[model samples]
Target: MWYLGSWMFPVISAAMWLGMLLGMFIYWEAIGHPIYPSMDRGQTIAYISDVGAYKLKPLFIAGACVTTVFLDLGFLAERWLRHAGRLAPNTSRAQKVLSVIAILFAIAGSAGLILLSNFDTYHYPRLHDAFLLLFIGGYWFSAIFLCAEYQRLGIHYRSHHILRLSFWVKLTFIIVEFVLAVVFASTSYTGKPNVAAVFEWVVALVFTFYVLSFLLDLLPSVRTSHHQPQGWALKAEMEKAHHGGQQPGAPLTNDSAGPNQNRHVAPGDDLEAGAYRGTSMTNGPGYPAEHNDLGRQKRRGIGRLWS
Candidate 1:
């Protein structure tokens, strides 16, 4: 059977998140935008949580939980693809650390979303607010870390414009969400519940775009029958260049040797009798007693090197 690329993860996540918010708004509006039990008299503008707390409790909780689960999965998939060389590898220790940190933050944000959805504002008001803060703050910090990581990745891999694009998308998300979140908080605290509710809805709407931005990051890793991902192609080119334009595991030969001969041994070439698949020159016993003249150790191959 045919399969779609991992990009579907973020697409489904964004769709579900947007659908949940839209469903709540439309349903509430259809019911004449009644003042929810949690609201004061004359307050006709219900927060997303307020609407979800009453009639659409099940839909809100399920949608938020499912959307965030897939969102976290998307973040995890990107990191895995990067390490597996299907996407651009992290070129520095800092990049690797930042990627992991970003994933952690995404997971934390997902947890907050799930918790806040379950803890309706009508009941656990304080806990709901706290988890909402966590949900927003977690994603904001995640975007910041991703922007830093992608900036470094883009610097090292200038040809991949997708990195730059993803960086800017996330940076824009951070800026927009930060501003809206601050305003939402200020309005909520200053007795302007209607204004806060409007900003809250806007914030959720803007967050859908943030969810969609992962598409830019994951698109390069997509593969199909007639197509290869740019990430895979670039990785292949780098590997080919590193191995002197010769196919990996091919017998290295010198001018004096036959075409198929493996007589030529470079400084760090695996010398374990043509075992080139897994044996590393420095990490394993690939270096036999006869090849002691080659004193230097190359990196533990591209995986560890890039990682």
Candidate 2:
């Protein structure tokens, strides 16, 4: 079974975010469920920032800081895993570029979230609103880049259906969040404070789903018996071979090719054998007559040249 330690980061981030928001809502409701500022007293809807801006400011700051930090770390770790070949490697130059761009946007989004938490809407309404835009826009743009990269990767690596699934998941999140954000902003600016507040909460709730979506991207990295060992395991294997006076076995060259196909075939090569042994190909019992003849001829030629 794969060690699931990496899975916990995003899970913790999502759980903390959901718990914090739910706690804020419950706190607001318990406190007489007052109307938002600049709205009629009959209107009970209040923006997350409104509820978070006053007495629960510390909770908001802490939650935002912790959530974004863990989320960023999860993304960074996912990128590292892909590069380290624990996950699928990005085969195209565009895919690599898109990946870097996505990470940059994610970092910007995390920064925006932290900034917004620090600059509360109660005091720095303008700065808070600006940071809110940065936060929303940065993450949405990040998702857009990720969707593009995953789409390309899915097309190239058809067997790994997880890439396709991840692309669709991020695409759906992008579309839904974009629409909700537009409506939320429109309502906020059009004097529909209650409607905006309702949409705001809906947006935050939906974002929790997006935050958790990273788990899908990371699922393919789960170490299995078939997978090649990595990092410390690789080092330990090498050290054991050194102390034991035995040569280490060849590493897996192609994971998607097939289990029995251990040898790599170069383009235009006609050889059909397991692998090269020392100086000659291993022409086994099942090899074709022509290949066997060629192997014998090569051995004779080498013997004559050496003599």
- Best model per lDDT: 1
Model 2, global lDDT? 0.81
lDDT of 2 by residue, 22-111 (tens): 999999889888765534344568788888888888999999999998888888888788788776778888888998899999999999
Clashes, model 2? 0
TM-score of 1: 0.78
lDDT by residue (1-307, candidate 1, tens digit) is 1257788888999999999998999999898878888985567799999999987999999999879988888998899889898788888899999989998998888889999989989899999989999999999999999899999998989988889888988999999999999999998898899999999999999999999999998888878777677668887878888888887777565543433255555688644666443344443455565553333433323443311
Clashes of each: 0, 0
Residue 38's lDDT within candidate 1 is: 91
Candidate 2 ranges beyond 4 A from true positions: 1-4, 36-43, 224-307
What is each predicted model's overall lDDT from 0 to 1? 0.84, 0.81
Error (Å) of candidate 1 at residue 58 is 0.2
- Looking at candidate 1, the ten consecutive residues that score lowest on lDDT are 298-307
